[model samples]
Target: MTGRELLRMVAAQVCVHGVMTGTRLAAPLLALQIGYSAAQVGVMLALFALSPVLLALSAGRLADKHGLRLPMHLAIGGATLGAGIAAIWPIFPVLCVSALLTGAAAATTQISMQRHVGRAAKNTSELKAVFSWMAIAPALGNFLGPLIAGVVIDHAGPEPAHEWGFRAAFAVLALMPLITLWLLRGAHEAPPEPSEEAPADRSVWDLLSVPQLRLLLLVNWMQSAAWDVHTFVVPILGHERGMSASTIGVLLGVFAAAAAAVRVVLPILSERVPEWGVVLVSTVVAACALVAYPLTPGAVSMGVCSAVLGVALGAVQPMIMSVLHQITPPNRQGEAMALRIMTLNFSSFLMPMLFGSLGAVLGVSGLFWLIGGLLVVGAPSVKGLRVDETPHERPGDPR
Candidate 1:
């Protein structure tokens, strides 16, 4: 892919994914504003991830069969429709539906984009660089979406309730994905690999038999759980501390900005840095940050913790994607990406409710420590990871 095309892809990602990110912030805060318990909001947040768990494999197969255009169109439509529904109704049930729709759409768009970019790269260094660029999309989306939603929520209407503000935010989010369609107008879709036609008997489960992929998935899950914990718990923590919606949004936005900043330099550093080394360091740093998170006394301190955590987690995806594309078969890349999304979203779907229940008993501090402890325990396993500078697929190898 040309640099311009790559940028268009990233912009498209920001638009579609931003809609989901904004909705995630808006829905939970609205639920809380309406006097719902944190547990209830957690259930609502879980809905955002639920569709991905159920539909990721099918989405991946679609990407493999049809390439980026078809999946992108479907994803754009789903996101637009979801946000539109919530904009009109702004009810709890409709918000849940919106979450499912937007989440599934974002995940599908991500799979198609990742598969396309991975296929475009010629070597390991290029893989890392491209994915590092691609990783910026989420960070940018996360930052812009929440920052926009928060500002709109705080200022768009007479306060105490901000019902109008919430609806307005949803309407804005509903329109963001349309920009993606325009940005991708002239983008090229690469032809599918010959081996894309996998036999009907092949199962995604078979990919797990590879020990490296298995370990990578485990590490990815740990990182994903850490992310979910922060996303789900931070708003509750802020609310409990009497922080305003805009403050909480800025806090989360700061995290995303920090993440994006790290990724911006990663492409330049891709050749010099070892992917495994980056992962190991990020794992350790993320654990430390999560442990420190609940100890912060104010928004500034919490923002500091969020920035630290963002930098740690932000550096991880490019390395993971680089290793993943290298290790998985070319024809099965979409399926492999799907499998990774399924694993991460599965935890995302359940972890919020688990965090809510556990936080009520253990407190937010305990939840952070629990996840942090897991990351610490899992950090050493990164040592076992190895990536080939040039990986060749073996003929007839099931992997």
Candidate 2:
């Protein structure tokens, strides 16, 4: 893809994914405002990830077969409808449904987009650069979504109910996905390679037999759990500390902004930086930051911690994606990407509820330490990853 086309793809992703991210903030806060318990709110948050866990493999296979156009259309429609439902209803039950819709939509968009972009690269360097550029969508979406929702929630009205504020935020989120549809106008889909098709007898599980891919997924799960803990716990922690909606949003936004900032520079350094080294350092830093997160005393201190964690986690995806595209086969990349999404969302689906129940007993600080400790344990595995190796190549085989 040309730079302009690549940028358009990124913009499209930001719009669609932003709807999901924005709702993630707005819905949980609304439930909390309505006096739901953190555990209940956790259930609601878990719903966002639920559909993706079940549907990701199907979505990936769909992308592999149909390419971007069909999948993007489905994603745009689902996200728009999902947020619109919450905008109209604005209740806990409706919000759960919205979460399911938007989460699944975001996952579908990501698989299709990532597969498309990975295929566009001519070499490993381009793969790194392209994925780095694409990875910024989530960070930017995270920043924009929460910032918008938080500001609207804080200022939409003085109505004692705070109902209008949340409704307005959902309404705004509903419209954001339309921009993605517009940006995708006239986009081209590459013709499928006959050899790229997996046989009907093939199962997605076979991809896991590759040792490098398995290690990568394990490391990714650890990093993703850290992210889930931050996203799931921060609001509860901030709420317990009696911070305002805007303050919490800004804290989350700072993390995303830091993430986006790091990604902006990653493309420039893609040639110099080894993907494995970056992943290793990022994993270590993220572990440390998560451990330190709960100790921050106030918004400023928490924001500082958030930024540090953001930078560490933000640098991870491009490297992982680059290495992933290198190690996996060209034909089955979608299944591999889907498998990664399934694993992460499975954690996302469970971790919040797990965090909620655990948070009730151990407190949010303890939850942070738990994930951080796991990452520390997993850090050594990063040393084994090498992009030069592929799943198809047996040990000691001639190139």
Candidate 3:
């Protein structure tokens, strides 16, 4: 992709991702205001993730069979409508429906963007770089979105903070995607048309047929599940531990910035290291950090561990995306990308409620200890990557 196109895509990524997940942090607050218990709050968050987990592959197949722009446009509309629903009504059933729509919209957005990026990426390394650099967008967006929401929540009541904030955020999600469409104006579609060379069966199940692709999806699933533990659990943990709202906000911003900073250089660094090797090392590093986090002296020490955790955690998605791009045919990029999203969302969807229950049983420190242990157990799963892996994109395909 041209630098200009890259910039536009990154910008859209930032806006959509920032809003979609930033609301996750606000969910507990919303739940509390709406008369839900802590467990209910976690359940609410996890419930939203179900559609993406179950349906992303089909969405991907649709994108693959058809095209990228159409799904993306529809996703933007879904996001807008979903957010509007939340803004207008904060009743129990409405919140559930709105959250589900938001989750579906997020899936729609991911399928479109990943397919575009996968089709556009010239090589495995470039794909990795594009995915990694794209992290900067959401990393930045996560920082801004919460701060904006926090300000609104603190000023407006908690109800307005969540209900209206989602409305405003989705309104912005709608506008940002529109700008990306405008920027991509006159840009021809890059996903390949089906021919004898590419398989005609581009179903979600087709996404599962390839063993190498299956491994990649597993990696995506595990990595997302690991990250969700922190994203959904940390604020709750912080609140329980007597951390101030401002401090929680500051720590979150720091973590996002740290993650972006690490990702900025990972694209170049990934070139020098074998992809599988990078995964191995990153997992180990992240595990060590998480293991240390619960044992740390306090928040200062915890933030330090969190930054280290960010560096390690931020590397996984791009590495997997790069590999997925390599194994997938250009024509099937949408299916492959959507399949990964589906898997990731599926593993993550149940995390919040499960973790909340565990947290309730185990206590906050106990929850962190369990998280640390899970990472340790997951370390052994990082075996060698596919045998035919290419280190970088070859010029034959088109850069």
Clashes of each: 0, 0, 1
| Model 1, runs deviating above 4 Å | 27-41, 88-92, 147-168, 231-251, 291-304, 356-366, 389-399
Candidate 2 error regions (>4 Å): 28-41, 87-92, 147-171, 231-251, 290-304, 355-370, 389-399
Error of 2 at 244 (Å): 7.6
CA-lDDT, candidates in order: 0.88, 0.86, 0.67
Writing each residue's lDDT as its tens digit, candidate 2 over 154-264 gives 888686328998998899999998899999997777666655655666677667778988999998888888888888889989999999999998988888788889998
Q: Candidate 3, 245: how far from true, in Å?
A: 3.7
- Which is better, 1 or 3, measured by TM-score? 1
Q: What is the TM-score of each candidate against the true structure?
A: 0.86, 0.84, 0.82
Model 1: lDDT equals 0.88
Residue pairs clashing in model 3 are 123-393
What TM-score would you give candidate 2 relative to the actual structure? 0.84
Give the alpha carbon lDDT tens digit for every residue of 1-399 in model 1: 889989999999999999999999999988888788987887888788889999999999888778888999999999999999998998888989999999999999999999999888877788899999999998788778887888888888788338999998898999999999999897777766666567677788778877888999999999988888988889989999999999998988888788889998988876887899999999999999999999899999999999999899989999999888878777678888999999988886677668889999998789999999999999999976677656544322555
Best by lDDT: 1
What global local distance difference test value does model 2 have?
0.86
